[model samples]
Target: MELSRRGFMKAAGAGVAATSLGAMGFGGAEAAVIAHVRPMKLASTTETRNTCTYCSVACGIIMYSKGDVRKGERAELVHVEGDADHPTNLGTLCPKGAALKDFVRAETRLRQPMHRRPGSDRFEPISWDAALDRIARLMKDDRDANFLASNADGVPVNRWATTGMLAASATTNETAWATFKVAKTLGIVGFDNQARV
Candidate 1:
């Protein structure tokens, strides 16, 4: 009558399996019911390859999108995971990369430009054109005011000290290079990238 640990585990497993099978109604008549169950949600989804944008690591990701776009339904992202074939990450993601879906679907994500006037306590949504115009005006004004054409030693170095540009790490190499060129042309010495930070 004495049961060893191995024997007890086997008996417990059998009992649990029996109970689960009973609850699932896996008998002859109910076997058909279980066969009619739907497949996994991501099984039929379309997959796209992408890279994580949080940092410079650029971990590859497989993004799953559902819905038929031809039927006036836009494809919605359903799932994301690290790409096993990628040489950089090798099917692994950091915490930030793993939670990228949440970031994309977050309710607090900004959909449009917002402006908070000086001495104002609240930010109001603004049009893209208005935002761009405001930014250009501010930059122009700051550059005109703080632009140093030469140092005290009479060195001809044109530089803008009031403004800096921080580029995103998700940008392609070509795009980043172009951005850097533009920043250098504008005499922005305080330029950096999100990856470095």
Candidate 2:
């Protein structure tokens, strides 16, 4: 056999190219490598069952948390996923439910009541008690000013036209019923539920 320089060069180039391509993952070897790399963060966490609060569907969720409260360290939420045993979700989650973990852990989430005074450009954090007091005072004033005792036909009627209550869809039926009763007692005629909207 005659060894030509051109043939030798071609063979060497092909060998180098094959080696480089294999190293750069031209084949499916990268997938195998990634498949073996499992996350260890959830290994020692505790799992709890919860319900999604975004809407009325009330999808079940499995919440994973770290540490144990009995051991002195507070448990922190680490992950959230649809609960397989839940009757509503059945191990599947909508886009919002799937991102519930991010929402719960988001840095921008409001932790306290905020109030922006008229003509103020920014919202100022307010205590929950102060916020509730202000809300009750304003609602009472509105109700007193707008309460109608009688119509033009001289019929006895009690209704407040200025105040409206929009109930959350995530509330349970009992809660909704209680809210409705409260609205009726307060003479609030303008009421709606978020689920209907």
Candidate 3:
């Protein structure tokens, strides 16, 4: 049924009154908000780019520097985000990639080699030099024991006693090159570098 002019005016006035009451908290607006709301803390920050080390995906990541931590300086890397402009991710990242910053700064990072004697309850830290020397010595001894100077037909072969090559990735260029040199000295035939792919 068509509302008379006076009736329409009355209805409009009622609607306005209800809205005002809700705005002023005279109605149950606050209760409605509380039922559907939760408190939130905000961060002030920005972004930057860094490579991904996790899988082979190598999606680009953006780091967000948040809340000021220093007396006069701005916050540093308070968060990490995905780089949308990166061709690989198109501005998206998997869970692992997204949390890259946290993983990098984790307190449990292994900063040094830890050695634990058999049956020992704890691990003792060791210097990198010592570790490298020990590994070199062990590898040398193994090669010496396995020296295979001949092929299947007994022809002279200069190859190492074993496969005669070492291969690995997950290292910087210089380090990988150094590793290649060491492997060559030991007559290693198989070689691989992470940078290959």
- C-alpha lDDT values of all predictions: 0.89, 0.89, 0.73
Local accuracy of candidate 3 as per-residue lDDT tens digits, 138-181: 77787788767788999976567455443444344586688888
Q: What TM-score, computed on C-alpha atoms, does each candidate reach? A: 0.69, 0.70, 0.50
Q: Which ten-residue region of model 1 has the weakest summed lDDT?
A: 25-34
Could you tell me which 10 consecutive residues in candidate 2 have the lowest summed lDDT?
A: 167-176
Q: Write the per-residue lDDT of candidate 1 for residues 39-89, one digit (tens) a residue.
A: 988899988899897888778999898887878888887788999998889
lDDT of 3: 0.73
Q: lDDT tens string, model 2, 1-197?
A: 98799999999999999888888878578768878998887789998888788888878899999989989997888889899998888999999999988998889999899999999999999999999999999999998888998999989789898899998876567888999999999999999987788
Show pairs that collide, candidate 3: 84-91, 148-161, 164-188, 164-189, 165-188, 165-189, 165-190, 169-194
Q: RMSD to the native, candidate 1?
A: 9.1
| Of candidates 3 and 1, the better by TM-score | 1
Show model 2 residue runs off by greater than 4 Å: 1-48, 67-75
Candidate 1 overall lDDT versus native: 0.89
Candidate 2 has a TM-score of: 0.70
Clashes of 3: 8
Cα shift from native, residue 137, model 1 (Å): 1.6
RMSD of every candidate to native, in Å, equals: 9.1, 11.6, 10.4
